[model samples]
Target: MRNANVMTASSEGALCSATRRIMLISPMPNRVRNLLAALTDHCFDVFSLHEWDDGMLDSLKPQLVIYDALPIASQPDAYNRWREQELQKASSRMNIPLLLLMPEEERQSLENKASVHVMRWPSEPEAALLEIKRIAERAQDVYDSRRAGESIVFKDLTIDPGKMIVTRGPEQIGLTKTEYDLLLHFITSDGSVQTREALLDIVWGQQFYAGSNVVDVHIKSLRKKLQDNAVSPRYIATVRGAGYRLADQ
Candidate 1:
């Protein structure tokens, strides 16, 4: 890792409650990097493995290692085989989460694997973020399961309408007030779609004229912390003629 990029320990101080050390294994795949960048204001320590030294197996520990969607190769068997080798021993931190972004078709083959969580790539971004949150939650469960030697399950991520906290699984996703309210509206619509207008109405409280794109900005912010894909999905379906919905997966 480059010293210029890594913050000094004194500057880092204690990890903020909302902050985490995330090590991403792939290049900014599927616009997911934008989402990670979105988290900068919230105190995230995001590092792409491409930026790490070969000694990652021994140093530069992180709370999670995300393996994002890559361009599909002509040979998937050879691809996955080679992929496995990279992950097999690189992460010595056993508790760290491994979030794998994949196509819906390829997801099943890796479903039974231990410690790896998969989200279908190529869905609209709305669905991707929901799935990312779901995956983060799942990773937390896996961590807990190993620690306590028990199985675990989670419902759609829980957002406290009153407390402003979003609990994805074992971890509480940190959210700014605006981002939290936006998600609350998305989840509370009973799976119904909400238009940009509706989102503006709910989130900004009373609409004004003019194309603000404010909704788009906030959505971008939400997507990063959730580690969502802009193209594929598991929740938050985009209704081209309508708006966005928490779709049934």
Candidate 2:
């Protein structure tokens, strides 16, 4: 029952709203340290954990999980068996993808096991990151399909178009019609910068209003409703000189 050590790195200049987030977990501190060093400048939002934490999996809602299965010195066989069971449960229950890194010897034992995918452990850090990227992209495609018309999930925020609902964590945030429409535009163009003029045209259905800060005003109001700070936004970020884009988180 050791306390978990956690490290999270969300890279700057990364496509904030477009990339899939990943959670990395291992019991060995040295292994976790090495992997974090390798992923120093990677784009994806990575939340690394050493030791088990029950609340982490649900709270993060990561698109992918990378489990580095270094054998525990105390009880290698029993620990791995338990981990396999827990991972299988997480995969089926949450529909979250799981990638396991284990020794070649363990592969034979895991044959015909549940849906957990495995890669030989202790590969070069770059190679591991590359494989993780491939899996995450594939998983993201499936995630996108399931979320297509039902709702949009970005970090902790969920926007449901059908119900005209917007929530941050457990609380529902009310928005004006215009604010909701504007937010929807930002979600649809997740990775792209949307200029104020562009937003005005799309959201307001008008040409151009010279020197009018109508877009800015609405954006300010919208941020207030979403509990987002324009200066240091959690959802919508003001891209100086470029306009606005949703924060990747």
Candidate 3:
């Protein structure tokens, strides 16, 4: 456990012979931590971190990495910069799955490189775990379907699903998994107005929070990445209080 506050949460079930190791690089709320404890028996070993280190990557060799990208507010610029650099190194150097939970305000400020997945914080533990499982499955699919070379063309944007890459004209747009999936849903729906609830169900696979503006934040992020104007948009269109659409027509 080192310096982390560790907990073993599990129900009445025999422990699995093999367990997937998870290195959590953030502070979880007590309620969420309690929920995560249920997963310990389900073949999951979670370890939270109060600090960052490169040696952990070598020693832990975790199957997945979940990190917090929240602002310290008090930390000096140099300290924050160094931590970010180290985080990047950990992601790039290790070919494992990396999930980042950050404040919506900090999303644009952080680099989207290194194939790191992003999700908003203050999420339900079960929902977060479910999302992580989905990502793991998708990663496996990518590995197995490496030779398929599958891609989808939506207007000027070309999405390579297998590689999780999006290219518009000549430049490649770096998008987190959620952003890419949301865009894919919009494009495939052919500009149909998608309700916020529906978007949450489809993209997140679960509605973790009701009346949360998480959807809007992600949509805003997608628009920014696609260079689509919010007002008189070329691609994504906000349907006032209704929802959002791809603006196909």
RMSD of each: 18.1, 18.6, 12.9
- The residue ranges of model 3 lying beyond 4 angstroms of the native Cα positions read 1-9, 27-38, 76-79, 108-114, 138-249
Best by TM-score: 2
Global lDDT scores for all candidate models: 0.55, 0.69, 0.66
- Decreasing lDDT order of the candidates: 2, 3, 1
Q: lDDT per residue, candidate 2, 150-206, as tens digits?
A: 677777778887788889888998898989888876665423456565566567765
| lDDT score of residue 167 within candidate 2 | 90
Once fitted onto the true fold, the runs of candidate 2 whose alpha carbons sit more than 4 angstroms away are 1-18, 150-249
**lDDT tens digits, residue span 25-126, model 1:** 654343565545443333546666543345662476665566764544676677666666654433222334566677777776555343345667645655
lDDT of 2 at 42: 67
Relative to the unseen true structure, what is the C-alpha lDDT of residue 124 in candidate 3, on a scale of 0 to 100? 66
Instruction: Write out the backbone clash pairs for model 1.
Output: 35-224, 122-231, 122-232, 123-231, 123-232, 123-233, 124-231, 125-230, 127-235
Better of 2 and 3 by TM-score: 2
User: Model 1 misses residue 86 by how many Å?
Assistant: 2.3
Q: For each candidate, what TM-score against the reference?
A: 0.41, 0.51, 0.47
